[model samples]
Target: MKIYSYPSHVKQDIKEFIEKRLDSGTFGLLVQGDEDTIEDVKDLMFDQDDVTGNGSGSYTFNTLKAEECLVGNWDLLREAKEELQPNVDLIEKGPEFCDVMIRCYLLDWCFNKALAEIVNNTETVQKGDN
Candidate 1:
């Protein structure tokens, strides 16, 4: 999947724009970056105190401060594909809607990757069974 990082200052605006699209029935997913990037994003989205260590090596966002706005991470997306069977599509609304289009492309890329893995595994199993 193509990774695109928006400017830190624009994250809130981006989230708001994404929210509107989501509200209008547009399906898009926002995958978080690495641990450091996650911390940076949390700083962009919430106050300092709202982000805390989860006792594990990683951190957790306090729900009391802000609602979860971003989509699931890569692992979560893969799990969702396996368990939830999400129907994904590449949406192209043209240049005027470039932002959402990019998101759609990313989601499409990720979904296709997962689908290919599933198909390959199925074929491997079938060959073993033969």
Candidate 2:
């Protein structure tokens, strides 16, 4: 997602703002701005937060009048992400945790499939006996 904070022409503030949010553990994905002039005001919202599980805040980059920063609360972002991918706790540390999650998901899928197959086989055997 791309965030357009007012003063898209003010590159420094936009970059600084995003970096601060990232360092604050507000997002997992990296943000990039400064698309135009170094002084151009703009902010880039990257992939949704992974570890933090947050969504992009709202904002308008270019407007006729001086625009107020439409910042989305971090809590709301967290809620939104949770709704989508709530199984994994976003606060877990590092890539190892992510790997564990993946493994868990795969195991769950396999277990479910095996259970279904067993049920089908059992039903078949019962019908044959009858």
Candidate 3:
């Protein structure tokens, strides 16, 4: 999916898709970025600890943080993809850091899908309040 720096009408499609799943009128989106990027994001939030909040705000933050982190290390993903080609399909789907960074990031996406659903549920709940 393409990342955006600003919230434009372009996101209307995803917003609508998310709206369809809002149970309580709230929608949430979860995205994964590189560990270094996540670390930087986590660092930026050093004092912000509340996980329960607006989905729109959180999604924007995640996308931005991931974009920064991924861009900073795009080469690592490419290298790993090249090096692991011999036996990539054999690796167990777990937290095992490999030569490539994006592999874990990609795996993080698999795990984050569930989180996105929960966030979507939250988003739906929030929408009902609007």
Best-fitting candidate, scored by lDDT = 3
Candidate 1 local lDDT, 1-130, one digit each (tens) = 3232322213333344334433322221123213454334334333221121212212223332111212223343344344433454313222212222222323333333433444466578879999
Q: lDDT at 41 for candidate 2?
A: 16
Q: How would you order the candidates by lDDT, starting with the best?
A: 3, 1, 2
Each model's TM-score? 0.24, 0.24, 0.22
lDDT of model 1, residue 107:
38
List lDDT for all candidates, in order. 0.32, 0.32, 0.36
Q: Model 3 lDDT vs. the true structure?
A: 0.36
Using TM-score, rank the candidates from best to worst: 1, 2, 3
User: What tens digits encode model 3's per-residue C-alpha lDDT throughout 11-52?
Assistant: 332334334533332221123334554344333222221221
Angstrom error of the Cα, residue 84, model 3: value is 6.0
Once fitted onto the true fold, the runs of candidate 2 whose alpha carbons sit more than 4 angstroms away are 1-99
lDDT of 2: 0.32
Of 2 and 3, the candidate ranking higher by TM-score: 2
Which wins on lDDT, candidate 2 or candidate 3? 3
